[model samples]
Target: MPRARGSGASAAAGGGGAGAGHGGGGRLSGAGPGGQKSARGTALPACLSVSAGCRSSARACREGGGRGLGRAVLPWPPLVASVGAGGGGGTRGWADTESVGKKRCVCLLTGAWLNGVMGRRLGKNKGALNELFSKAAGMLACIIRESAALTRDVLEQHFNDLKGTLKKLLDERLMSLLQEVDAIEQESIKPLDECQKLIEHGVSTADDLLREGESAVHGDVGQQNEKLCIFTKKALHIQLDSLPEVPSLVDVPCLSAQLDDCLLTILKNQIFRHGTVASRPPVQLEEFVEKPGGILVRWCKVDEDFIPQDYRLQYRKGTATHFEDVYIGSETEFVVLHIDPNVDYQFRVCARRDGRQEWSPWSIPQIGSTTLVPHEWTTGLEGYSLSSRRNIALRNDAQSCGVLYSKAPTYFCGQTLTFRIETVGQPDRRDSLGVCVEQQNGCDSLQRDKAVCISTNGAVFVNGKEMTNQLPAVTSGSTVTFDMEVVHLGTSSNEGGNFKLRVTISSNNREVVFDWVLDQCCGSLYFGCSFSYPGWKVLVF
Candidate 1:
């Protein structure tokens, strides 16, 4: 009647008890050995239910009794019991003992089994929770990294655009400042130039007077007095009383300081204001050829925010050192007259804002030329009859044809030459009028065999060969007008150096137009008329 073997023994040996194993359930059940009902329910193990002394005594007694056996079971706490399978009045007591033992075994085994299952489940859940947290953390970290990268790229691109804009604005402002400085420099030197010219003139005149007085000393006495009086009167006529005072160079420092201050003020007001940047200059400043030695220049503003209140136009000749102001008012265009014909000129323009003292930078300089005025005509023939009126009349001779040519040559680019020829009598095909490019000394006679010419019949002859057959006829008493323009092609040695000549001839409602590409003659070209028929008079205007 040893104690029944059950899972309680294994659980107690592994440091587990009913109360500790079943999540701290302190009760134990007692049932019969054959699974009969128990008098009491599950009961707590002795180790957990009794005091320390009682647990030690019980363990000692169980060890002593079960020494011979290989396994030992600790005693349980005394509790009520149920009956065993052997039922009788006398055997009831023994039956109850067996039942008590069986019930304790069953309770211990159930507690241990439940504890093992719960432990495994808890371990699995712990691992799953840890994995979930790790995954969530990793996802959050990835999102943060991606967001940071995007933010950095966006900020970098924004800064780059801002930098480019700032650079553009700065360049525009610098160009404007440079233009203003150039204008100021030119204006400042004008008075000095005028004063120098006057001084030079006075010196030249004084030297002439001294030389005249010295020469008069050797003449006859009466003649000397008369010559002296004449020289004295000539000197008196040159009035120097109103000469402008020369500016002192010592004042340059003071003037420069004032200029710097003025420029600083303008910069602050126009360019360096709180929230403004630079702006572009006005749009294209165009120039057109005006009749009679003049040019018409015009411009338009593109920036609407910067409306100009006034415009200033300045121009200079090819050999000039300073630009002279041509117009300074609100007009967008101006006519600059008195320009020398066939001379190269450059023009610039600036605009002033309303209530602002500083003028905008000058526009890019435009280069152009005035219309050419033909030089006096020269001829080599002696028997050729000529008449000098407002226009020149050349009477043809049969023995010697007359060839009249200009003395000076004009530029091939941007030049227009116009003239009219009226025939008095019937003219043959041999009588021609056009422009030619030949050696200066080779143009002595009407040599149609050695030069290029456009005939009155509108045929173009190149080097004495007919190049074009389109001819406009000129009848007797009819006037033929010719207009020629020379255009530059480019700057290459073979192409840029060459020029294209456009010719238009009109007479009696008939007109002929043609263009010819000419090689670089590099010398002077002459505009002239040639005639061979006698009694045929041609008047050139």
Candidate 2:
């Protein structure tokens, strides 16, 4: 199905599944307190798209209509014995229930009610009949006690029957889905168990051999006669692989705070202690240039408590993505490394400490961007307001621009892209603000000449020259607002640097995008900034 792009406010409000592609678009639900009913099965004011042959049920979607909204009154479970009795065809299609006989019965009932309410009669004495029905002997009993009972009986029976039929249909559907899932589980898991057993056997055998002392292989004459050979250094030297470079600690990304202390201890012992057994280090980090072709990714997790370094770290069956499938000795934290850097990649880290078989939830997936330049994306702009009545006079003037980071280390080429900003708050005189877009080449804000900016004054300028577009006016008491569109069209003179959008007052405009000074850093109007996807493919030659 086609999907709509999400708004900036939606992403920052991350408590719900408000992503652009999943779940509802963050709209408020119409349910009342404790989910009380406001109308027939549905709360009033709820948005529902009606399908064909759903008129009776559809009436509940609206309010203030005459005739009570007909709710889908379902029957008791175990009431519907068979689908065949509930009309062989599917539920309530136009052809199944709209026969000539049914139509006549409905019309007759409708006419009777209209005639009685309008004070009309079947023949010439309309007035007399109306007076008789209104005030004659037992007039109220005729309508309520007698007529209402029959109508209610018929409706109740039909509703009960339909309810039973729907329940049966859903039960059948669920059973089918469960069977399919069961088959899939059997097919995928049976072989995995067999493979795991074989791996365990091999490890056991290797451990036994390594445990045997040299005495098991050696037949010495006597302890005193035993000779130890020592030789001088040989002319020919052996060449071996060089050690892998240590990765930066910051490269690990944000991890669970609970695991921080435990992870530090593991890294200290493995890297700092230089402990090894059998002439091989307990932990080895090796790097090699992959043959410019297919590549592999690996993940490792450890238990929390102190674990012996000799613990085996080998891949196991059924674990498709993790390398060295062995759980790192009881360390509650995990560290991930990009064994191969040429390919685009992502990795997940999960850990469980102290013999806890249930693994902790996997950390958020982290993607490694291939760009040489480093940049950061913002959370997008949100909840902003215009301070003064003058600023509310225009679209560009009343709006807020969000922050976008370059994934690459630098933006070498200039390009134009739209930045979506969101905001809501009270406005005041001191709450000054403006949009700042410029290239950051290290400490200096480079390319001051080719930047673009918009401010409360409703003016847009690039390279110190005024642009054609002007800001729109704002309305009072408006909480949410967005920019129509703004672009950063790069020029030939300036290129390459980090870009940051600083919300500031007009007086402090210092970072000049295309030579237009954005002097202020107004924090009052500040909500936050929105980040772009990345720097790669953004800057074109």
Candidate 3:
């Protein structure tokens, strides 16, 4: 044995320096002697204790501390005094023995249980963390790429519509401007043409006057007088007009576009900066409602000014650090399905606008859980046996249908029971699966009078009455799922009013839905199923 370097006299000076030595859990700092240090700077010796109420096994444990008992073995301490024996003369501690001690027959110590537990737990935690991280990363990548692409497409479509409208508007304005130019041309030309007509008439009148004057000056005495008299009469008949006043032709109508010179440039700059991805998310998580087998996560836009084109929801398990995108769409409320019962989940929402590259910041996370209980097979009879909580097996000896029941009643609305047909001895119409209001401890015929079930064929039986709803036919490998909820309970406790039960069964690409109304109210319902054939295996979740 390697003795402790610190002496026992210092430990005996009353500082809780006892029981400290070389072992798996006994090593302490250089505290004069071995022991657990106290808050007041004093050390106290502590013997090994068991939380599961072990009496004799407590003090005898040397190597093992509180962790080992079932896997136990005890080795005798060597014939040396404890390292902290008072001046090597105090009461003997568990570590020291006067001679080679015998193994305590009452208790055994198979040590290192805590180390094993830590090894397993840490290893599993790391693997789970990696898996969740990888899934979250992949989900985020898909949301980013797909959301951005869809938003881009929608934005382009809207822009295309805007461009069409703009083109039509510009065309209308252009036509109007051209028509104004035509009007100006017509108006100005009419006046100029009238002035030209006046000028022509005046020139003709002046010519007639000159002709009379010339005839009168012919220089002949008798003939000149007579000709001048005729010319004078004709000239007097021609009324003279003053010179016409004409407008300058340089004054002409011109047309120009009304918009800015850099119309395209203005549109480019404005449109480029018109839309924005939200900097801070306007949507805030409202509440989480507990449903039968799911949670309804709801959100709302806090800032009415910031209108988002879409919203995306994300969630994570309570113990998880990373959250994965669960939904992305315009609906503000989404029901997350297939969650384990009673397990806590955290959820958040983000927003994105049209033509935006990124989603808005996530809303503050909210925690939620479902109200349904965990499902397990509680009763199996005759040829029916349970392999696990979710699996059921039917043996070859089963003459009639083997039956199984859930561990407890599931009456919560929206809770669904899903079963898969893994194997079948043979396919027949006799095979049925459904839920009932009663549970039997032994194999018995299905109480069809109070239950609803579906067969391998397309027939459905409701309360002992067969109804052909034309549901899809099932074969060896079909999946069946069913759920029931109370629509309206009886109004009076005396069972005098109407009670409604809404039951839905889905399988083989079709669903059979029916509602039963009676005079009595049913507070709860139990789920079970019976199979007539042998070698058929079913698993439920």
Q: Per-candidate TM vs. native? A: 0.29, 0.17, 0.37
C-alpha lDDT values of all predictions = 0.47, 0.26, 0.52
What is the C-alpha lDDT profile of model 3 across 157-248, one tens digit per residue? 88899889989999998899889878878987788788888888778778867876886786588788888888778767766745667655
The regions of model 2 sitting more than 4 angstroms off are 1-374, 377-409, 414-418, 422-450, 456-458, 471-541
The CA lDDT at 530 in model 2 is: 23
Model 3 pairs in collision: 16-43, 72-110, 73-109, 401-531
| TM-score order of candidates, top first | 3, 1, 2
lDDT of 1 at 521: 37
Worst 10 residues of 2 by lDDT: 73-82
Error of 1 at 130 (Å): 80
